[model samples]
Target: METLDKLFEDTLRDIYYAEKAILKNLPKMARKANSTELASAFETHIEETEGQVERLEQIFEMIGKSPRGKRCPAIDGLAEEAGEIMQEAKDDMVRDAGMLAAAQAVEHYEISRYGTLAAWAEKLGLSDAVPLLQATLEEEKLTDQKLTELAVSEINVEAGNAAEKNETNKPRAPKKVAAK
Candidate 1:
């Protein structure tokens, strides 16, 4: 019979893997982003992510376990989707929009994972672990909020305008109305 302690450890490993995976991918996302702001966001996240990993390691030490990670399919799929956006969206504005969306997806995933881990730590009476997890959770939320502000302020509108302009430039087929 597995206990809450085992489940807590397993969840910890999952987010640990996810944060490490994110660190590897953030650089590519930064390079691919057409927006200077978007690129900077990714770059800043890389540093913050490094700190988040260290915090996770601290939690592991607190519980007397080695810092390790299990494979996380959620993050893998999100990273793959982001790669597809970079490859598929040719226009700078359109690509920025896609990249921003991809980043938000990742932030949402991390927010959920960290929030749950913090709650579980509290439940399992691992009081020391809760604050570290919560801190990371707050960072994830702030990242998500920043992405939302960027999307609303610039990316989405620019992408939409580009699409609209392109559509207007294209030849439209004439519609035939019969039996009026």
Candidate 2:
């Protein structure tokens, strides 16, 4: 039977890959964000992600394992979909909304993963790693909450207004050029 330590190590590698992938992708998300607040949020999270990566490295040291990443397909797919959102959204406000949604998806994924890792660490009696995992978990939750606030307070309303304006200004189908 695979031991809990083995499972923990496997999960650590998964999140290590996820954090590295997020570090790579956050800059693009920041550049594409339409709202100043959204862009700043992405930039700030990049720093936080860097710290999270360092924490993962620390966890590897505590566990006597070399810090390395395993391919995490979930994060890869999420990042890919975020790219698609940028391409598909024509309106700036709507694009910002999409970016926020994409960011939340990432945060939610991290929160879930970190929460699981923390639980596993605790169960495995890896007392030292538990605090580190919990710290990242809390940060992910806070980031998710911030995205929620931004969406409700600004981005969603702006997107709705933009969509409304687009509908209002839509050119009427060239009045049926009735064939003579």
Best by TM-score: 1
Off by over 4 Å in 2: 171-180
Q: How close is candidate 2 to the true structure, as a TM-score?
A: 0.93
Local accuracy by lDDT, each model: 0.93, 0.94
Kindly report the root-mean-square deviation of model 1 from the true structure over all alpha carbons.
1.1
lDDT of 2 at 72: 93
Q: Count clashing residue pairs in model 2.
A: 0
Predicted candidate 1 versus true structure: per-residue lDDT over 1-180, tens digit per residue: 198888889988999999999999999989988789889999999999999999999999988999999899999999999999999998899999999999999999999999889998999898988989999999999999999999999899999999999999999999987986
Tens-digit per-residue lDDT, 1-180, candidate 2: 289899899999999999999999999989999899999999999999999999999999999999999999999999999999999999999999998999899999999999999999999999999999999999999999999999999999999999999989988776666798
TM-score of 1: 0.97
Residue 150's lDDT within candidate 2 is 93
